[model samples]
Target: MSTEISIKDAAKQLNISEQRVRTLCRQGELESRKFGNSWIINAESIDKYGLRTAHMVAEDHPAYNVNEKCKKPIALSFFSGAMGLDLGIEKSGFDVRLACEVDKYCRQTIALNKPDTALLTDINKYSANEVRLAAGLGKDEEIDLIMGGPPCQAFSTAGKRKGLNDERGNVFLKYIDLALELRPKYFVIENVRGLLSCPMEHRPHEKRGDDYPELGLDELKGGALNFIINRLENSGYSYSFNLYNSANFGTPQIRERVIIICSRDGVKPPYLVPTHSEFGSDGLQKWNTVKKAISNLTSHDHLTFPEKRLKYYRMLSAGQNWKNLPIETQKEAMGKSFYSGGGKTGFLRRLGWDKPSPTLVTHPAMPATDLAHPVEDRPLSVQEYKRIQEFPDSWDLAGPIIQQYKQVGNAVPISMGNAVGKLIMNLLKGNEIPSFNNFKYSRYKNTSDKEWKEQFSKQVLKHKESTEQKELGFG
Candidate 1:
């Protein structure tokens, strides 16, 4: 399986000392043969040992690069929360050279995991020179990709639909600025689906006896995403934006996101291919259930509830809600909420043992959106949240147990991250058409709540000397 070469030749090829080569061979990190007067090593053995040689291939296999067969591409990530997306992309073969984030806990999480990686606090404060330095490259180093999901609350369905003026919306714009400044070969913009309909400006009302502003959808010029696309196109980047269902990409949760991909070189727009289907014929693959993600986690002993909330979720069977309870019991449990008209689906709900989990929120045990466990009377545990989000068991999350739950709950799932990373890799490799026939987001059974006070206390104690925490007012 390996070509035979002399020890001196192998050392010369690998650009290392013969002593080092011999040491590696002695330790079995590399294999060699001794024939009468000389030592010979196999080419395959050199490759297996990842020894860098001038003539032979010293880099990773072409198939291993997600960019398909192109040269190894480097990346820079922003708003890198717990680095779930970055982790997946790195696994898929893109070299993430540097990361940017503002949250203290998230920064801690990134430091804990990727200690060797260069991490900066804020994208706004980062300069091109600093970025180059952090990447350990010169100013002319080729940056293949820049990816990020700016906070979407400003463009979320629940927030005020203020487009570019909202501070958070400006942050998204800042990400655009960075992209233009860096001019990476590829760029990604991620946000909530509400960006499709969020208004740019409020319509003015006709002059009346008393002056007051009138608001209507027709009065707005366009959605936030329209402006975003226009800006990207104007910057000389050919781009495409679409709504992607995370379920289609192997995440158990049915989370949908608006993702935009842009390229500076005017290449074909990359579309992610799903690799798993919930109800497909292959049968070798199926949508992962909540149980599959979390069944292995040990249950927590204490059933802690949020502060000042005497109400706790009453355990129920699968596919059952508050309506399943005795009529009198329902009325007593729901109180005034029972008298309300709309479908109060959150009341007394239990996750099915076989389905995917619903969208996880900051607090899982809120009365209006109760996510009680099927068998247990309490909410889901902190470890369970990480599993549902596809975070590795060995991954360490910072902050108190409650804050950790909140951070993980708000993250993009790792399975979906992996799919996106692979797609980006394909783009880097010049794969024009990628297969995505298998993505599906299936529903499953899944819960959490501890009080803000307790979580804050724990965070303060946990990061008493954190400089970023003090600067960000998180202290």
Candidate 2:
């Protein structure tokens, strides 16, 4: 029942000690049940259990419990959000001994799910030696990997794309330096797809046309990543990267992320091998769908939409958006955004049953990016978000429900994590796993390390030739 509460919460509501509440449960004055040792105060005992509890006790602390006696490969994680990527690596036979995160909610999540793993804050504040010590590695124990998806808002396409100029982007650069300093056998950097095209030094669009000199290398698109690659090359590391669709790796959501796998060893690892594909091409499985992900759910915890929005939702069918409504209704539903440019596909939209769900956003009910359920009159629930992200059904997220959604939404899909792990594992075992030829890694073009380098070279050459023409009166 929804009214079921936790004993800790019951103690607060009933104004009694948690011990007193436990005694009541023992004396049969209250009805309580257990899920992994945490108690759930039953709905039947409304006076004692009350409505504060949501019927689930989150004894999910040991979710990623590891055996200390067994020494798998060692890894250090930074900017670790919800440990989604770390879990994938852990499952791939790595002992993830340390995780560094700055978000308070994420720290709580890490403490809950990985009690034994060392937790740190602010990647910028810690030295490489401090990080190694925090991970509990003895002086001679070498690290196999260092991984992070640094705060990516600087390179997010939705933002102004400040790239390395932004403070957050500077921190990303710091993570890179740390990796090199620590000298892990391999290092992985996961980031938003926008990183592929972001310039190292952004120039305002208004400073363009004949008014500006030919854009320097730092100002050109893809310059930021080029700079990062150059930094690694100067340090003697080889890398391979690609923009990968999470759906291609068996995730139910169609989120695309850029994964850069680097090595202290000379040879670079291949692109992540796919476990699924669109249309099930190349003998891979078909893309997982949201309908397949949540069809059996009988109950869900969720945030609600306003009645005004619900009325329009009732008029629309699964897969329909504001465009599906009557012309007048569409205008009303979209308001001024109806007249805006680009197909506002997210406005007043309902998810399609057959298709992979859209990229999960931190907030599902934001006007321009609604993520309503296909049949229900609400946005995708936090539980649904976790399932789509491939977190286990019982993985207890920390923070309030809204914060919970943010944590899950921002997570790297676990399937993608597993693929990253598998690739690293193969490399460590001296297995060279080449990717399937001609496979589409993502919707974008020229994003692979090979393809992107060629493109960057061409862009640089074009700029060089143009500058020469201006100098020699060949223009």
Candidate 3:
């Protein structure tokens, strides 16, 4: 016997009702033997017949509280760093009743922002029961969606690409487990693009030799994404995943992420089509420009500029890098980097007055990756960073000024979140999908705000100028 389970246990384990499990047993969808007056199922049969859906496990079935109407769905957030994703989801139109995050700083941040929603201290210490209590629903309530992107450090291209074996990578797996336990209708897993090509370990053959590489402290013995997908499929869900650029979804910065959508319902998995394009074509809109995002804000004193560096950037023009500097000044200002290989593009780089900004990393003043204001001579301040990233002015971030800058810079843009939120709302409401595949927002619909109209119109004019320049073949 390979860990036999009762038929009722099988039903609970698979996140379905006992009545359905009994039917499966009768119809040969499940394997069960009579024990006492009831049927008992073995682990093998459980694996064979059970469906593993995202966000809900067999244990979570008891905690489900949704009725057949599937009214308001509760969300369970995992690896909830700074709650950027959660904020976007909420803004778009879902209720986030509970969140699980491990970092003390992030937790404090969450508490500051959303004091009423139940938040778990550590993801590992939480179970489905805890989630239900926090969500203010019973085990029988159906959680509509489970969402989160575990910390992306281990899976990022900038990092070692350690995949599932990294301790941080294990949190990704734990997210899957919670989804299965909760049996939510859908789940969204967000990660970096590197997950598509991360090298993973093969499932070991029972009798095979043990020459595998040393696994990390809590890393799983398989490729991170693959292991996560396999477990979800085994538990009974269909998943669709792809990489998307934040700029395409109205974010001012050029950031890309891989979004994985999973569902238990046997339907086409929802995919997010691009809503903003770099260049308009076939009625698609161009990407949002950095100027459109932050041009209006009055310049506050920048946070990082020492007196000397600040004076230097003041001399540069928007869209000009060190290459535009006088040859003598370039050598003197750039120092060793002037002789370095590859495009030291960031050296003295200034944002183009008409184009979207590059990704904002933790530090803006980093050599070879300067993010100086187009007109000002210094790196952007915390307020400006938040404005560019689309975070509300009222949203509070906890930390020192630099720490605040880092957190805000690391955040997913609010506009991108809004886009994702709209799509999610449409999906949950069973409405016709919005025009996501099409990218230009300017021509879609007119807004009534005079200032917004003026701002957006100005960018259109600048974009037209750039287009004409391209037509003339100007560099």
> Considering every candidate listed, which one attains the maximal TM-score?
2
lDDT of 2 at 338: 86
Worst lDDT 10-window in candidate 3? 52-61
- Tens digits of per-residue lDDT, candidate 2, 1-475, equal 3578888887886677899888877786678776676677875463423312232222212113445577688888889999899988888888888888888777767766666788888888888778766776666678899999999899999999888999999999999999899999999999998899999999999987665687888999999999999999999999999999999999998999999999888887789999999999999999999999988877688888989899999998899899899999888888888899998999998999998999999999988899999988999998899889989887767767888899899999999999999999999999869669989989989889999999989999999998788778675
Give Cα-based local distance difference scores for all models. 0.67, 0.85, 0.68
Against the hidden reference, what TM-scores do the models get? Answer: 0.71, 0.87, 0.70
Off by over 4 Å in 3: 1-71, 201-222, 299-301, 434-475
Candidate 2 lands at a TM-score of 0.87
Candidate 3 lDDT at 131 equals 75
Displacement of the residue 6 alpha carbon in candidate 3, Å: 61
Across 354-397, the per-residue lDDT of candidate 1 in tens digits comes to: 86777776667777776666666667776777777778887867
What tens-digit string does per-residue lDDT give for candidate 3 at 1-475? 4787787777676787888877777776666776777777766656533321111211221222323344455677776766778888878767777767766556556655665666776677777777777677866877788888887887787776666767877777787887888888888888776665554542334433334433321232224555566687788888776566787777777777777788778555656656667786545578788788787887463556666565567677898888887899888888887888988887777888688788787788887778888887778777778777877777766545666766776676766666666766777788887444433323222211222335444644665675566567662
Error of 2 at 452 (Å): 0.8
Quick one: best lDDT, which candidate?
2
Please give the range of 10 consecutive residues that has the lowest summed lDDT in model 2.
54-63
Order of all candidates by lDDT, from best down to worst? Answer: 2, 3, 1
